[model samples]
Target: MWQRGAVTDSAPLDVDLALLGGGGAASLVLAALDRHGVRGLRIAVVDPVRRRGQDRTWAFWGHPGSDLDPLLSASWQRVEVATPARRRVLELAPLRYAMLRSGPVYDRAAEAERRLGAIRIGAPAAAVHDDGDRVVVRTGGDGPTVRADWVLDSRPRPPARPGRTTWLQHFRGWWLESDRPVFDPDRAVLMDFRTPQPRRGVSFGYVLPVSDRYALVEYTEFGPELLTDAGYDAALTGYRDLLGLPGDGLRVREVENGVIPMTDAPFPARPTPRVVRLGTAGGATRPSTGFTFSAMYRQADQVARALAAGRAPVPAPAYPRRHRWMDAVALRALDRGSVGGPEFFDRLFDRNPPERVLRFLDGTTSPAEEVAVMNSTRLRPMIAATAGDAAHRVRDRLRPTRPAPAIPAAVVATPTPPPGTGNRST
Candidate 1:
């Protein structure tokens, strides 16, 4: 813990790197540095509240043998995507859909911090300034100030510029336990569009079954605004009924909720020579899917490689400019009433191979493959959207640079049943 002290301009601690927030990004950075064999560097991780429990969950599809394999709570070989008209179960042989909880990640980070002899400052960074050669970080309430040659800031901040179309990928999940064998542990439901759709955007149900009787069920939406507390509960209740889980011996074990902004805005990785952004602020989250775990890992690895090479530790761009442009067009189509979410995603998986679609989402597919994937969607509407997005870009370039408004924060509802419910049945 950082010690409280009298206010002073001089920093009490100096290190090679200072992580502004001790969240998943900070932990991943440390892991990446260790993996890249860059060690013995003084490091400090600063945050008012570090995650220590299963406060969140992350799901991504990746090839087997990842460094995070040991920490995975569950993995599914087959992923199911269902619409009202058709349901398909696609096998991800080379790649497995995996789930990770926050608790184990935090525990691993703690061990890494101890191994590196890094300082863990339990205080919020009030201000961070890049003073030419070094970065200065001032903690809240006169806590010890820190100076570092480089800083990876994971604190929540807005995008570098505004985007043309923005939507909130908000979700609320519940851990469920039932006496009846209600779930198939081998198969995970990626998107079950059987739920009620929103008037403007789209809503879907996501289920990850850890066992025959235990699963994490969620209600997700990609829309302009967030649902109210009662609204989400009602949706979840309807979804539970839709799944046909027995109501008598069912229990809500835990709850997790969050909102990720899905926008085409540019989140610059390095704002200054000595100061770089990490996590969502660094464009780790994909504008289309709100998936950040894989991208965060990629960003951390890039930064570690640069540091190991004795170069300016700037992370690579999260996605190619062409991918960003494509995402902007798709987002515009979704924002307008051009296509329904169910049809858009249904054709995405139904037409292309599951692996190709996943690769496209990860921005790894070739131009030829990408054209095929785009052609599967509503081409006419997408083409119109592309023209509009191109015009918007040209207008921005012609106009003088001005500060764009940050993405609006969506309304987040408190998780139901609170924490510590344990295995009690409802």
Candidate 2:
């Protein structure tokens, strides 16, 4: 049992737990706690802005009967993956690919905060200090100080350690409403590699059709750099032509764009004994594939279980150690030009069953299944990459600590959508 209190002028706002960021991570953690029937805990969620609009889109493949199914904007059991040479349309029987807007999630979180009597601090956390016993969080601009037994910090920060290879999964998507029915709402294109490839890294087109006349078309690239506004728009234009959509009748209702880090850096979850990290900061984003929503849920569930069992609230690893090692090798190969990105991914889906491959990507494959999936890829190059990456790690460990070279401004800039477009952060 815990006591709830309001902020006072003389002392800090004391609570059992403090969430530094009121984004998807904090919300999910709170939901997990509720699911486990954990009660009587005072919680405070601190963030500069509690955005509650349709600011982002989250897509994942899962079996039906999830509580979030009602909030899905679109879902499909059939998906298409294509290359210039061939295309495979897969039917996912037990698993369905789903897209969910952020608005419902934010709305549900707000309702939970009200019902749970949780405090909402609409201020940016300037700093979080774990003082051995209690974690103290200071907010920006003379905001209230929050002291709690545990702190879950989800605020974004640079990686604590440098990785051998890092790539940005950057993209711009446009929500289009057409004058005529053109899209097949039943099928979603996961990756269409018809777009011209960059000198380095891979580029692909993704399409999610919500209706016959409405869809979200995106141009995505996984590389060390981001594209300029004109560059992304130009690629989208070319992709639109390739899809044979009418030129003049398509209306861009909204635009979404963001960058997700795909790296093998060690993002330690427990920064301090009582301070835990969540979201991307806690390594929720998968390095090989920039998928995070499912991983975040898994992390949150672990944290809840720990607390319920009278243990410290610590989230588990988003992916197993062996999985991370495999992702590291894959990233290294992609960065070193040892594997052509399109050909590699094409071979993965073309040679293996879609269910096995998708499960492997989500880090749920058994050891034998994983071996089979690995066998489907070009084994020689991957084996060479494994050896090279291992040698590099050994060399790095023996060398003195050095700061990573600064990335170029053009390479790390947050992509901006074209003029006259509303933006959503993902």
For each candidate, what TM-score against the reference? 0.92, 0.93
Expressed as tens digits, the lDDT of each residue in 67-137 for candidate 1 is 89999999998999999998899998898999988778878777777666677777889988897899989
Error of 2 at 153 (Å): 1.0
What is the TM-score of candidate 2? 0.93
RMSD of each: 3.5, 3.3
Clashing pairs in 2: none
lDDT of 2 by residue, 207-240 (tens): 9999999998999999988899888888998999
Provide the lDDT at 50 for model 1. 62
Query: Using lDDT as the measure, which candidate wins?
Result: 1
Looking at model 2, report the run of 10 residues with the lowest lDDT sum. Answer: 406-415
Query: What's the C-alpha lDDT at position 141 in model 2?
Result: 70
